[model samples]
Target: MTNVQLGAPNFRIVSTNVSGEASSRALFGVSYGLGMAATQFALIPLDDERTLYKAAISALWTRFETENGVAEGRKLALVNVRYDSESINTFFYTKVTTVVVADVVEFE
Candidate 1:
């Protein structure tokens, strides 16, 4: 149970309940394996940060699909994704790259 103050005279209350079996194991806790890939953009004019991020993620997923067998229409899923970005500044422009690492999981 909780109370949220929206404004000076407005308020809202919320409540939530959860129940689960003790023997049930969490899905995210189980990691079949992990894969990592990097995408680089050098002297490329990108529309925005969102576009850059999307491109980086797409490249990582494509690598996984091609080499790691995480192809399309598969029951496997990627979770707990982590990534790092690096940029190199030069006299004329900057080169940016991102490395993504994620754990793979398969559904029963």
Candidate 2:
């Protein structure tokens, strides 16, 4: 029998949803690993929550890329994204801190 060797995967999984429900099912042979981040922001009551949430995710992705030295064209995939946040109320504004932990994968 000939020995078969497997190479790197051609694709990766990146999802913002839990349960992998909104992601493509196409199979990839390999994966990187998980990444976690804590992002904080101070906002007045009028600040947009949705926008900040999106920013937090973006920051997390940036952090992953910087730490991993991932190539520019390479894509970052996040799955099983678990998010938690805490709010500290102050006299002038609220400080919101978020922690995001996910199954992070890097692929071409």
Q: Which predicted model would earn the best lDDT?
A: 2
Let me know the TM-score candidate 2 reaches against the reference structure: 0.46
Question: Highest TM-score: which candidate?
Answer: 1
Stretches of model 2 off by over 4 angstroms after superposition: 1-50, 91-93
Instruction: Tell me the tens digit of each residue's lDDT in model 1 across 45-94.
Output: 43344334466556666666565564567555455666655545454454
What would the per-residue lDDT of candidate 2 be over residues 1-108, giving only the tens digit for each residue?
533232856555543332211111112121111233323333323434434446666677666666566536765556577766554544454444555666666554
Clashes counted in candidate 2 amount to 0
**For model 1, the run of ten residues with the poorest summed lDDT:** 15-24
Per-model CA lDDT versus the true structure: 0.43, 0.46
Model 1 stretches with alpha carbons more than 4 Å out: 1-50
CA shift of 81, model 2, Å: 0.8
Residue 11's lDDT within candidate 2 is: 52
